[model samples]
Target: METLIVLDLDETLLYAVQNKLERDEDFKMGSYFIYKRPYLDHFLTLLARDFKLAIWSSADDVYVKQLVERIKPAHITFEFVWGRSRTTKKRKSVTDDYYFVKRLSKIKQKGFKLERTLIIDDTAEKSMLNYGNAVQVAEFTGDPVDDELLQLSNYLQTLKDAENVRIIEKRFWRNG
Candidate 1:
């Protein structure tokens, strides 16, 4: 069974240099740019080489696409990038759950189930309370240029072994 790797955009893989929502035609104030955060390329490469990759950010698709292009440059195989347009004040609204759930449900519909699927997100607003197949990486508010990737890396390394997923669940959600 191919594992589905869903990732969040802002603050997970990339930090916004500028408020990404600034480009909104409806924005009365300003927005920013999404910049790559640490462990992004390396982790992405690892996922591409191992599990099937998909991005399920709360942000829109166009914004996510631009970030993907900027980061990978070369086309690394990705299953999908599930996202939505920034048009509301819903805090963490999702417009791509159809794609998100379908991917998982397909595995069930096809008579297969994941031994281990993973999600690396910075917020619980979407993935945590809803998806049982996710690991939330609590957001770190600091200079992006200085944040360390070791914590994320250590967790990823453990995922290579079937027995160590508890580390992911325990650590990711502050899961007590």
Candidate 2:
């Protein structure tokens, strides 16, 4: 079976802002500007060949659905598209601030093996419960020259066939 890769939307794949960036926005949604990460199309196309993809964001359910519809390639079909409603709310120990977390156990309940699952997200707090399965990427804020997706694509290729991805060290993935 192919590895299951659950992707984050806000900063991992696209940067959405209310104010416009110096460069023109790729598209607009309501009052926000959405900028697609550099090489996003190519990255998705490449990974779709070797992995079962899904979208899970902590943003509004309706917004997440709309954004995915706009950005996803017609040929690429995600295993699931989830939003804030799917996350578990937790309070931070130090700051007492509430945040949402994506528990991989939900995916496991859906029949995917934890050892072969990966979640690509920019915020560490969101995936704190599953560090071993998390692949942290830099937050994207509409940098026209950003190449995170390109670098990530190359790194992921090395793990496509891993017997147990959770055992691999992914903290230094950029250097992989």
Name the lDDT value of residue 39 in candidate 2.
Answer: 98
- Candidate 1 global TM-score: 0.64
In candidate 1, position 17 carries an lDDT of 51
Winner by TM-score: 2
lDDT of each: 0.54, 0.95
As for candidate 1, its clashing pairs are: 18-32, 18-33, 19-31, 19-32, 20-32, 22-31, 60-84
User: Per-residue lDDT tens digits of candidate 2, residues 1-176?
Assistant: 99999999999999999999988998999999999999999999999999999999999999999999999999999999999999999988999899999999999778899899999999999998998899999999899999999999999999999989999999999976
The TM-score of candidate 2 is: 0.98
Regions of candidate 1 where Cα sits further than 4 Å from its true position: 17-31, 73-75, 85-114, 129-131, 140-142, 145-148, 161-168, 172-176
Tens-place lDDT per residue, model 1, 11-44, is 7766665444333221111265454555567767
